[model samples]
Target: MTRTAAIIGGGVIGGGWAARFLLNGWDVKICDPDPEAQRKIGEVLANARRSLPGLSDVALPEEGTLSFHADLSEAVAGATWIQESVPERLELKHKVFAQIQAACAPEAVIGSSTSGFKPSELQQGAARPAQIVVAHPFNPVYLLPLVELVTAEQEVAERAAQILTGIGMLPLFLRKEIDAHVADRLLEAVWREALWLVKDGIATTEEIDNAIRYGFGLRWAQMGLFETYRIAGGEAGMKHFMAQFGPALKWPWTKLTDVPDFTDELVDLIAGQSDEQSGAHTIRELERIRDTNLVAILRALKGQGWGAGALLTDHDKRVRAATALAARAVDGVTPGEPILTQARAVPLDWTDYNGHMNEARYLDAFSMATDRFMEFIGCDADYIAAGGSYFTAETHIQYVDEVHAGARIEVKTQMLLGAGKKLQLFHWMYAGERLLATAEHFLLHVSLETRRPSEPGPEVAEGLRLVAEAQADMPYPEGAGRTIRRPG
Candidate 1:
């Protein structure tokens, strides 16, 4: 059964929440009085659709339905998750909570996307205070996995965490709620220091941004604060580093506790500097740029299986399992037929200057297909870890058509020969019915310990025997043995 999520505001954050849930196969109902809510949310959703699916190697679930409602009650009618992303006004939040609780299911998770307000403050005089929790997400909620879940009720927090994880979000359950929650408090300190820097003419907006992006920001992205400092301690650990640098905390190195006057001069100065720095691109362009960079960073992290990338890896496993279950339910895999190995969207990074998929990505996609095929034939990670694996010896690729970023692509693999230490396969890549490319790969089963060709494990050999026997009568794929030829 498809779950339903109600977005109580259709602005950037609300639209992002809607996109996240909807893309994860939850029907979404948006409630916002703004006449432009539909357009705004549509724009956000468009960015999401182009970027989010590409984050995973496996294809995401089919998107659920999206609808807008002017009436709060109608929107929250069947919603299992209701996210409140209204402007940060205590009175306004109370009013919205009252309205949401009145209409929404008592069991529905009421998540507030408030950066500063505590759950206690939000739950004040609510119909069901326990149902309300803080689920503050960063901007571009579709891509970022972190959601600070703050609540006093452990049951509600646990339920919310499960629901958020289903939608590819990391719910960091807070033990106790404070004025500004964890991340924002840290961010506020940085913001305050940046402002002082600007106010003192020590750095411009761009310089401050550059200082972070080009410097410690990269370290912070992967290792975070304490771990990075721990490394900085060199032979010693965090204790040594802290003992050396901890005393600097009392020095006048930062104006974090101070605030610049809220004067128009400061505002104008900051805005003017910001415009000078990034006035060339529109907000949409900037958002796309940010998303693209984030995708690249996260994908890189995924390769290493660290930090947020580990979360993505976990999500991909879930996606693969779910996809396999769905496929099995529909039409069980037939042995003789080509196996559907890979189904995914072309990531933004796969494109080049030509605006279509770079030629190299063809092999990359085929490589993933090959990996999937190996798994199907029982030569998975565990098998490799146990000193048995296949190494690609030769490959031939034919690019029949061009595919662009965000295009849904699938790879079907057929076993040509699977016996002894030899494994030959053909892969056909497609976008819908259009043939995008084809690759023929020849591989050798090897022993990782001795680093030489070796007889396959019993299970792997059996799997290969079954597939080869089933596909014995199958016709050879066209252009299977072809090689590069000069233009006629």
Candidate 2:
């Protein structure tokens, strides 16, 4: 059954939450008072569609239904998960939550995306306070995996964490409530430093951003502050490093003790600098640029299977198992419609200097398609782990046309041969109906224990036979046996 989520606000953060759920195949209903809420959310979704699926080689679930609601109660009705992302005002959130509680399922979770207000404050004068949890997600929530989960109730927190994990998020549950939570507390410290730097003219906004992104930000992406510091400790380890640097806390290198007033002059100075720096790009344009860079970095991490990349990998695996293919899970052998071997948007990072997909990514796409086809043939993860799997013996790719970034592409597989130790397949890559590339993959079944070619299990063999028979009547694909030539 399709799960339902109700989002109480439609701003940047709320829209991000919606994307995380909706793109992951959870039916989402949003309540926001803004007249432009639909348009705003549409813009966010557009960027999300272009970026999120690129993080994984596997295709994401078919997106869930989205609807806008004018009434908060109507939005919360029948929702399995209710998230309140109204403005940061405590009174406003309490009012919204009251209406949400009146209509929500008794066991449904109520989450507040209030970065500033603690849960204790939000639950004041509210109905269902015990169910209200602080579920703060960062901006661009669909791409970033970290979620700060804070609630007084243990079971509530655990259940919330599980739901977040299902959607490919890493929820950090705080043992107790604190204003601003953990990440924000640390971020607030650095944010104060950056503000002071700009106020003092020590650095411009762009320069300060460059300092972090070009330096420790990369380290911090994989390792949090303390772990990075531990590595800095080198041969001595964290204790020695802390002992050596502990005294630096008193150096007053930061303006954390007091924040600069948001006076007219200071505001003008910051605004002027920002305008001179990045005013040319619209918010939507900047979002795409930010999302593109984020997708590239996350994909790189996914390759390492560490940090955010691991989150993405988990997301992709669940994505395959949750939606379209869920009914045909490995345990059940019933064949359904030919599963989509690949359905993805060309990420901006995949483009070369010439602004088309790099020559190599075409093969990458084909290889992932081959993975999906393997899953369909019943020789997937489980079969491989049991000591038998197919190995790619040779690959031939023919690029017929250019594929650009943001293009939605799909791949269709044709079984050339699937019997005994030989498993040959062909995939045609398409940007909509236009075929842009064709790839032929020849594979050999191998026994991992013996390190030699071997016949697959009967189940796998039967599965392959079905696919081969299904496509046997189809005409042979063009460019099957063709090789490169000076003149043809």
Candidate 3:
């Protein structure tokens, strides 16, 4: 079914929500009274369009329709999912919720993107309290996957979670209402510590930030505090670590006695330090730097299948299943073979100092194409799970041209030859209309159990034979097999 999402605010958080829904193929209608709402959301969407899809090679759903409305009721008329992102004033929210409750369809689920408010508070005086759930998300909602769900009713929370998950977000449901919810509570604790560190002249804001970004942030990115502590416990785990560090908990390393008052003098001191620290970059430049670093870090984690990396893995699977790969010759005897097997956006991290794609990414693109080729020939996840698979024994690559980030790239795969346990294939990679590189791979069918080269089962072998025969008459790809020789 086509989905319609209504966003009730047009600020940073609201604009981000709009981007996530609109880009994920859900028709999005936004209601914001501000005259500049359209421009605000457009700017956010521009940044979102550039960053989010580049996280994975697979394509996102074709973008859905976007429209703005002057009236709240008209904006939300047919929406199945209504998200309220109005300002955080209690009276203002109560009024907004009442308006939303009156306008919302009975089947629609209304969510509030309030970081600090509990769902119960947001639903105060609402006609349908059960429909109002808190679905708070971080800034740049289009990229980050985590959404904290807090609601009075369990079933409503679960339903909201399902909807968020469909759009590639990880919904964390809170059983009971809390002032700040889980993540904010953790963030508050760190914030307090950082503030005290700054106020007491212990560390400057930049120095403290560097401490986190350089030292513990990387560990925290993949392994949360508890897990890292658990490992610190050594062979015995959490309990052992607790025993060793229990005494230090009372030490005066932290001055978390209380929050320092924001006196004018202190405020100026902090602001001055910030200006000197990062005054050269605009907000947008800083944002891009932050986002690029996040993409790189998350992509690294994805490689290891941990933390936010795991979220990317899940999103990529769903994306691949929904993407439009070229005509797949699954049975191998199909009439027209697939010319293009794998398509992906060039992620930001693939570029090096030269501003073009680095040398190694060409091989990575070809390798995924080879994976797709195996899928075409009937060796997919299920086949590999049953202990049948192919391993790349050797590869040769030719770099033809330079490609840059945000370029739409694809791999056109054709078989050179395949028989028995050995199969050779060629992949031509293109950035838009220009061929960027070519790769040749030699693969050996391997039985996972024996860990040795072996003949594939009946189905895959037949598939390979059909493909080989279909391409048998075609001339070999240029530079299929080559070696370097020096003048002797």
- Which lDDT values do the candidates have, in the order given? 0.85, 0.81, 0.82
Clashing pairs in 2: none
Q: Tell me which of candidates 1 and 2 scores higher on TM-score.
A: 1
Candidate with top lDDT is 1
Any idea what lDDT model 3 has?
0.82
Model 2 TM-score on a 0 to 1 scale? 0.57
* Better candidate by lDDT, 1 or 2: 1
Candidate 1 residue-wise lDDT at 153: 89
TM-score of each: 0.58, 0.57, 0.57
Predicted candidate 3 versus true structure: per-residue lDDT over 87-183, tens digit per residue: 8898999998788778879779998888899887887788888989889999889999999999878778778988999898999888898998899
Candidates 2 and 3, the one with greater lDDT: 3
Ranking by lDDT: 1, 3, 2
Instruction: State the RMSD for candidate 3.
Output: 19.6
Lowest lDDT 10-mer window, candidate 1?
324-333
Cα lDDT tens digits, model 1, 19-61, are 9999999999999999999999999999999999998998898
